[model samples]
Target: MSPSKVSTIAWDSFHNTVDGKPRGGKEKHRGVNPATGEELWEVPIANQQDVDDAVVSAQKAFESWSQVPMEKRKEQITKFKEHYLNYVDEMTDLLCEETGKPRQVAEMETKGVVGFIDFHLSLTLPEEREEDHEKVMLTRYTPLGVVGAICPWNFPIILSLGKVIPALLTGNTVIIKPSPYTPYTTLKVVELAQEIFAPGVVQAVGGDDKLGPMLTTHPNIQKISFTGSIATGKKVMAAAASTLKRVTLELGGNDASIVLPDVDIKKVAPELVMGAFQNSGQVCVATKRIYIHQDIYDEMLKEMVEFTKTIKTGAPGSNALLGPIQNKMQYEKVQTFFADSKAKGYKFAVGAPEVEQGKGYFIQPTIIDNPPNDSRIIQEEPFGPIVPTQPWTDEEEVIRRANNTNAGLGACVWGKDVERAERIGKRLQAGSVFVNSWEKPTPQAIFGGHKESGIGGEWGKEGIKAYCNAHVLHTYKQK
Candidate 1:
C-alpha cells in the first residue's frame, strides 16, 4: 500500500476538545509516524488551564448527561457506532501511521471499539426491588462525575473508548488524555462523539508528561481510569489518593502461555506466534513468556521457529505481517534485551542479535531458546517483538513458574484434552485465562490484572459497572 493510499485524512491542525468543540493551545507537540521517521501531525500540548477547562466542561456536562434516560444514552452510542463504521478505512489509515501497526490489526482495534459499545448497550442500569410488603430496596449505579481517562498508544481507539463509552453510558462525563505518541486517532474519535454527545459529555486533551498528573490530581475529577505502565500506574494511583478519588488502572503484563504435552505442534505454533507477535508484541496481554512440557519442547520449538520465519516485518505500506515498533523508547527498550542476550550468549531459534536498520523503529521478531528463568528477558515485560520460551516437566512446577511474576493480566493453556488444559489454566494467576487460544478477550469477559498488572478491570457487565458508584436506597413501611 502506498503512503497516499494508506492515509487520506487531511493532516491539518489537531486540537483538543472542550465542551463539544475543537480548541487549540499555544504550545504544540509533533506526532511522528513511527513507520517512516516523519512527522505525522502536530497536536496541542495542553497546560494547566487547558486541563482545568476540560474538567470543568465535563463536570458541567455531567449535570445534564447524568440525568438523561438510559435509552437516550444508548441511542446516542448507537449513532456514534454507525458513524465510526462508515469511516473505518480512514481511521485504520490514521491508526497505522501513528502506531506502526498493520492495516489488519488497526481494523481489528476499530471493530473492538464497536464491540465495547454494543456490550454497554446490552446492560441495564441497576434495578430496584421490593423485599416484602411496605418495604422497598433500590440498588442504583451513579456516575462518578468527571472521569479522568488516560489511554496508551497501543490500541488507542479501543482503550480510550473502553473508558469513554462505559463512562458516558453510566451517566458520567469524561476528560480523556491520550498518549502523545498516538494522539491523532484518539482525538479524531472523540471529535466524532462530540456530534452525538452533549458538550462536556466527552472531551479529550493531548499533552506531555505533565498532563497526566494534572488529570489525576484534579479536585473536580471524581474518578480515573488509566492504562499504561505499572510504574506510571502507581503514580496515578498515589496522586488520586490526594482527593481519595476512585481509580481503575490497567497496567503491565508479562503474560505466560503454558503448553501441555498433549497438543498438536502445527496447530498451536501459529497461535502462539500470533499471541506473542501481534502489534509487534506491544500488547499488554500478548504472551511474553512460553513454557512447554519438556516431552514436546524440542518439537514445539522447531515448529514455532519455522512458523515465525513466515512472519514479515517492514514499514507500514509493505506487505509485512508486522510493522515497526511504535516509537523510539520502545525500540530502545527492546534493543536492550537483545544486547543482554548477546552478552550472555543466549541462543536464538530465529532472530539475530543485530537490529533491522531502516526508516522505521524495526526490530526482528526474536525467540530465545530456554533462557534462564532469572534472565531479564524472562522476568521483565519487554513489550516488544521478542519473546522467551522455556521447558518444564512437572505441571505443578510450570504453574508455579507462570504465577511467579507480579504481572498477571493474561495467561493461556494449550492441549488436546480440554479437562487437562482447564486444570492447568486455572492454576495460572491471571485475569483472563485462555484454554486453546491466547491474547483474545471477548466483550463479555472481565479483563484485568492480578498483582502489579493492574487494579480493577474493563469489559463485561462488571466493566460498565466500574465507571459507576453503587448506591443503595431503602424505604420502610408505615408500620
Candidate 2:
C-alpha cells in the first residue's frame, strides 16, 4: 500500500501529535534556528493535562496492540519506514533549520532511522523454551507496555526512532519526548505515523523541562529510554524509580583515541579529526581527546592541524561542513571551557583559541596541543568544537590515561597492525572500541555506557531485551 501524499507529507509544526492526531497544548515556545539565530517557529508545550491524555490513550490502545500478530505489526512498521523515507528530505530541511546540522549530516540522521527499522525487522523474540521431565516449563518474551523515549538534541531523529521502532515492534506502544531544542522532525515523523498505526500506538509531545519528569514519573509508563548528559540521565533514572519502571539510559562520554607510532599520519588524521568534531563535537561517543605515542606525537599533531584547514564552519544551508551549537545553554557552557583553556594558557594547534562573537552560536574548531591530563578541556565533555591531544611515552600509560575517566561509552585505537590495534582496543575501558577508524555504530552492535556513561543499552538483541519481560510458565500432567 502507498502512503497518501496529503497525510504523510504535510506537518503543521505548531501542535503536538497525540493519539494519532494534532492538538493544542498548555503553552507554546519558539525554537531558534541555530544557523541564523532566528526564531524558526513556535511549537506547543504539553502540560499535565496533555500528558494525561497521551498516557491514557496509550494504555487504552495497549489492550489490542499487545495482542496483534507479529507479522501484522511488521507490515505496519514497514509502511511507516516507507512513508518516512518519502518525507525524509523535507524532514532534513526542518532538522537543519532547528538543529543547525549540515544538510548531508542531517539527512544521514533522518535516513539512519530507516536503517534501524530495517535491522529491527530482521530480529525475532526468543523462541519459547521448554524443559521436560514429569512436566514442562516454558519461557516467554512479552512486551512491557507503554514506553517513554526521551531523546537528546544531537541526532534527534535517529535516536528517537531508534527507541520507537524496537518498542513498537516488540508489541509495546511508545510516547516520544524529544529534546525541546530539536523537537520538530521527531514530532513530524510521529504525526505522519498516524496514517499507518492505530491511534495511541505512537505519539509525540514537545515541551520544556517539566515535561520530562511528568512523563518519567507517570506510573502507567512501563519503560523509559533516555539519551542525554550523565546528569540528566541520572535524574531520569531517579524519577522513573518512583514507578519502578525499566530504563535504558545512554548518557555522555569523554571518549579518547590512541594513535600508535606505526600508523600512517596522513591516512588517519582526517578520520581522527572528523570523529572528534562531527556534529560539532556534540556526539556522545565522539572522541573528545587523543593520545599519541611519543615517537609520532609531533607528526600526528602537525597532520591533524593541517587537515583542520579544510573544514568550513557556517550556516547549515551553506557549503560549510560544520554548524553552530544547537542551543544557548550548551553554547555558553562550551564558552566557559574555552575561557578556562585561555586562562590556563594552553597552546592551540588549530583554529583560534578565542570564542568569536557571531550572530549564531558558532565556535571555530580548536585543538589543544598536549594539554595536561588534569586540564578541564581534556577531562570533561566540552560538547562543542574544541579538542585536546596528549603524548604518551608508554603504551600502558596511554591506556591508563584513556581509561582514567569514569566515562566508558566508546574509545578508539589506531595502529598499523590490526591485531595490535585489537589488543590495545580491548584494554580500553569503553563499551565499544574502534580498532582503526572511528565509524558510527551499526545496527548490529550493542551500544551503551559503562561506569558513569549509562545503564542498559540500545540496538542488537541484547539491547532490545530492555523493552521486554521474560515470563516462566509451568505445566504439569493432568489426571
Poorest 10 consecutive residues by lDDT, candidate 2: 4-13
Instruction: Tell me the alpha-carbon RMSD of every candidate.
Output: 3.4, 1.4
lDDT comparing candidate 1 with the true structure: 0.87
Q: Tell me how candidate 2 scores on lDDT.
A: 0.88
Model 2 per-residue lDDT tens digits across residues 187-273: 788877888899999988889999999999999999999999999999999999999999999999999999888998899988999
Q: Estimate TM-scores for all models.
A: 0.96, 0.97
Q: Candidate 1 clashing pairs? A: none
Q: Write the per-residue lDDT of candidate 1 for residues 124-213, one digit (tens) a residue.
A: 766757577877888888877999999999889998888888888889998999999999988988877776678888899999999999
Q: For model 1, where is the 10-residue window of minimal lDDT? A: 1-10
Model 1, 45: alpha-carbon shift in Å?
0.5
The TM-score between candidate 2 and the true structure equals 0.97
